[model samples]
Target: MTAHVVQRSTAETTLMRQFETEKLSSSPRRADAFGRFIAGGLPTRRVESWHYTDLRAAMRDAAPLAPAPDSGAIEDARAILTDRKRMAAWRIVLVDGRLVAELCDQFPPAVSFSREEPSPVDVDDPMVALNEAMSVEAYVLKVADGARVEGLIEITHISTAKDARSVYSRVAILLGIGASASLIESYLGAGPGVQRNSLAILTLAEGARAKHVVLVEDDAELHIESRLGQLAAGAELNDFVLISGGALTRRQLFHKLIGPEAKITLGGLTLLDGKRRSDTTLQVVHAAEAGTSREYYRAIVDDEAVGTFQGKVIVENAAQKTDGAMKSQAVLLSPRAQMNAKPELEILADDVVCGHGATVGSLDPEQLFYMMTRSLDRDEAESMLLEAFGEEAIRRIEDDVLAEALRRPFWAWLARERVARVGGEGEIHWVESAS
Candidate 1:
């Protein structure tokens, strides 16, 4: 097999040129966004936060921008949102960067909505700039203060491109004080060469409660980058993400505890095989006193797949009594498989407890053998052991249905493992849990 290059390509210059050609009918904010994109270019491994996953080299060969499909089969892909119980809650749907009004439900009557134009962030982020410059539609959702939506709200992003395509999609959510709801977002696709840039900004008012879940399962060849921001005071935010498909994917999440006594919990699961790659990077800020945060991530890597996790927690001087902890574990299924994890904590406040842990290893053969000796076959024993390993972190999922659905891809991957010949397999069978 040819080795995958980890070097930057000429696309940085090419992407800059392509952005210049488009007569950007952008506002000052949008123009600033474009400027930031050009300034930051693409994130590289050299950047401390992006040291594990290098987009400079991974996306260097990406094709030029393409238009969204005029019309193609989009119904089948809609299965990601078919649950009516969940469908009755969301107020927005963006299909390949464009709004799909027909499939979107209604928002609470007390809430107001608008998508006038794209706003610029102060940071010089190339990906953010690209998304702001190229995106055509924006979905904005707001929940009325003191209101409660008992059902789950789902935001489905479907890639309907037939061939090579590029899309920029954006969404903004705001929850009023004392309001409570569950939000679900999914990235689904059915094409060969499609790349997507997506962003979501979420705000929680004082004393509000919100649970957010993201599921990314698109074409194995699709490239995806998503940015999510959360702000709350005395509010609570719980985020859970499950990533199973994508040629290359990264989800960057930022959480700001702006109000005293606010709490946040972040949890996720990643299952990859073959040469697939997924990165879940996060940054949490304890900007207020008595704020607390916890994060845990588990990854199952097989084949020659690569997994990266970069987590950072910043505690401000005024943020006393802050408690933060992050832990990550990866089970490699192949000798060629790779996993990199970095957990960082920066504190200026005394009187706080903060710690992080990271571990990388393969399944223990002794345990496997012991299980098999109990009358179970190799396949059954391996599957059972693997499930037990993942369940440790998966049990944290608040929703049982979501947890079961997250296990489907893993079981399927295990079922496809070559059981006839054990010696023929490499240290980590790309098909088992490692590549």
Candidate 2:
């Protein structure tokens, strides 16, 4: 009998070799993370957690890690700094996963920033493990107790490498008790055929309040983001993710309510076209008493696009009086477009209230006809309905400025449906007929 060998894929082989040479491979934490990654290789369709989108198949080739962005790339990124007044919030620029201090703006006095990486937190997610093992740069932002950050903090991640590359980045934000702040993460891709792994860990002290937004600028080959957070007593967290780019994207969030009376509200909006595939997965746990969480997502899939939303909420036995709701809605604009929504709730508490639901459909023909009766073009009518459908999630943003800034990307995507790019964020094809 001949000995049998299990052949690994090129991507897996490349990452395996890279793990052996990882800069932090000597560290026990990174070594463990790499061990976890190697044990699984990559998440495949067989993995229950990654059933909708098989990351292993999507990443067939392992692109070398991107280098620190060059000066020209940094300069080009700076040129994209527009509406200084609108996005005026402070800035932290990360060019190709490495921070460029000169490109960043001044942070609030109550805020302290450092490039030092925190001790890695153990996580089970494959994406988080990959980030821990391969990331080249990491930072931590601290907000002092009783302080209110005057300006929103914007962390800009720019991928300027024009070749096939992989960029790993990580960031952590810790808000002290009674501290309040708004933060934005802008993910900008400079070119095509790049794989990016990004991770963010947020911690909310007792009585702290935070609003965060993750905005993906444009299309990328593969973009995987994992966000983990914990909330203390009386803490509040409101988060939103806009997935308008990436040919294949998977965003996962895992949060736990460890303190009593905590609240978490999150909304996600995904706009996909062509052959794009985007998956948003969330898992929230209520471990204490009187916790409340609401999660809603809306996806607009066009052409041959595929969109998925997988959300689950769990209430522990100690979490009496817990309240949670999760709903996902999707509108498919093409017959070939596909959507998968799985909303789940696992409750161990008798007195807790939790429910989950999902809905999928195309635009209402009657509504479209009504708009057309009012002299609206068919395509324009369809676009109007799509915008209206997505606004439910956008309106959840309490800050108008932040909401407007977030809206621009959607309008730009709409314009792409019928016209070429103009100049400004507000310069959508208002007068142009989508037809």
Candidate 3:
């Protein structure tokens, strides 16, 4: 199981010949998007949505530079964005990836924006041409027509140390007709050689509505890759993702409905222990006419960690009454931890109603001997039957302090992998069986 093949270095072609003339202002579409980010320079695993995260061999021993703006690393990224107490609404701060316009704030001039340049399907995506030749700044937010944004809209990606820093950060969200909102993208950190690269673009008009949340805790030797896009027309998108810490964590979500009754809801949660690694990739495109998509993913791999889920649903042919469903599930508790699920469905509408499902198991020894016959023990009956199968997928996140703050680091990584599998702190036997 080995993978790594990424090109275009010479310090990323001399940092794209110095941001190709400062991203050609007065746009010729930003000079053909800086010539399509100098012809793509960062996505590898030969693409297919980055086939299981391979940012050019994890930044090919990264060091293409971009991390020297320290004010004690912006006061340790403003004390981890003021200890995010379920932080809601208004925030757009970027440290290592630049953009801290005096701690960001000011945008409601009937919300309008620009600075979008880079396309040619992003020239075989080298992390979208290294975030379009090292993006210096961009935070376009528009929510005009029928706007209703009373709370929640945070975008904070702070970091300190953990070298190899390259942040081509961009966030352009446009929501108009019947507008509504909630956007949260937080990636925090605290030392230990980190690398962060991100890109986000969202647009929704006709009947627009949105709710997107992404949080990646840092410093388990951080390495993160993120890309997102959700377009509209009768729009309704609710995407959620959470990954605890990181050694190598990847997240990508792309959805294009285009118009007609569009609706999309994709959720994901990953908690990998020790030798950490988490990857979540999803793509859904109906492209007009009765569009509807729903995807659900859950993972919990213990020590020697590794979790990956690749989900796809594409229904073209003018998407006739499309209604798609995708589900990927996993629950592995060590035994050299690892979980991989791939769910796919691509149908050229035959009056479409697509389907996909995948499951990887472990931990249900009859619900831990019926919660150890009632009095719970065996690591509290396997953490109460793995928190009742992760509280049936975190009660489908209807937000309760953000689902108990994402289940408190997934129950402290299942009580430290149940004391590394009963080497101690074991006993709470409440034996009872049935069902």
Go through the candidates in order and give each one's C-alpha lDDT: 0.72, 0.85, 0.69
Task: Please list the residue runs of candidate 3 whose C-alpha ends up more than 4 Å from where it truly belongs after superposition.
Answer: 1-119, 122-130, 135-164, 167-191, 198-224, 227-244, 247-252, 257-268, 272-285, 288-292, 299-318, 325-369, 374-380, 387-416, 420-435
Order the numbered candidates by TM-score, best leading.
2, 1, 3
Count of backbone collisions within predicted model 3: 19
Better of 2 and 3 by lDDT: 2
lDDT of 3 at 124: 39
Q: After aligning candidate 3 to the native by TM-score, how far in Å is the CA of 278 from where it should be?
A: 10
Residue 223 deviation, candidate 3, in Å? 5.2
Top of the candidates by lDDT? 2
Off by over 4 Å in 1: 1-9, 61-69, 73-91, 108-124, 220-222, 408-435
Highest TM-score model number: 2
For model 2, the stretches where C-alpha displacement exceeds 4 angstroms are 1-6, 82-86, 420-435
lDDT of 1: 0.72
Return the lDDT, model 2, position 105. 79
- 16: Cα error in model 3, Å: 13
Our tally of clashes for model 2 stands at 0
Relative to the true structure, candidate 2 has a C-alpha RMSD (angstroms) of 3.8
Question: On residues 150-236, what C-alpha lDDT tens digit does candidate 3 reach at each position?
Answer: 767677777666565555566667788888877777777735565566777677788888777777777635354545555566788
- Candidate 1 matches the true fold with a TM-score of 0.87
C-alpha lDDT of residue 386 in model 1: 70
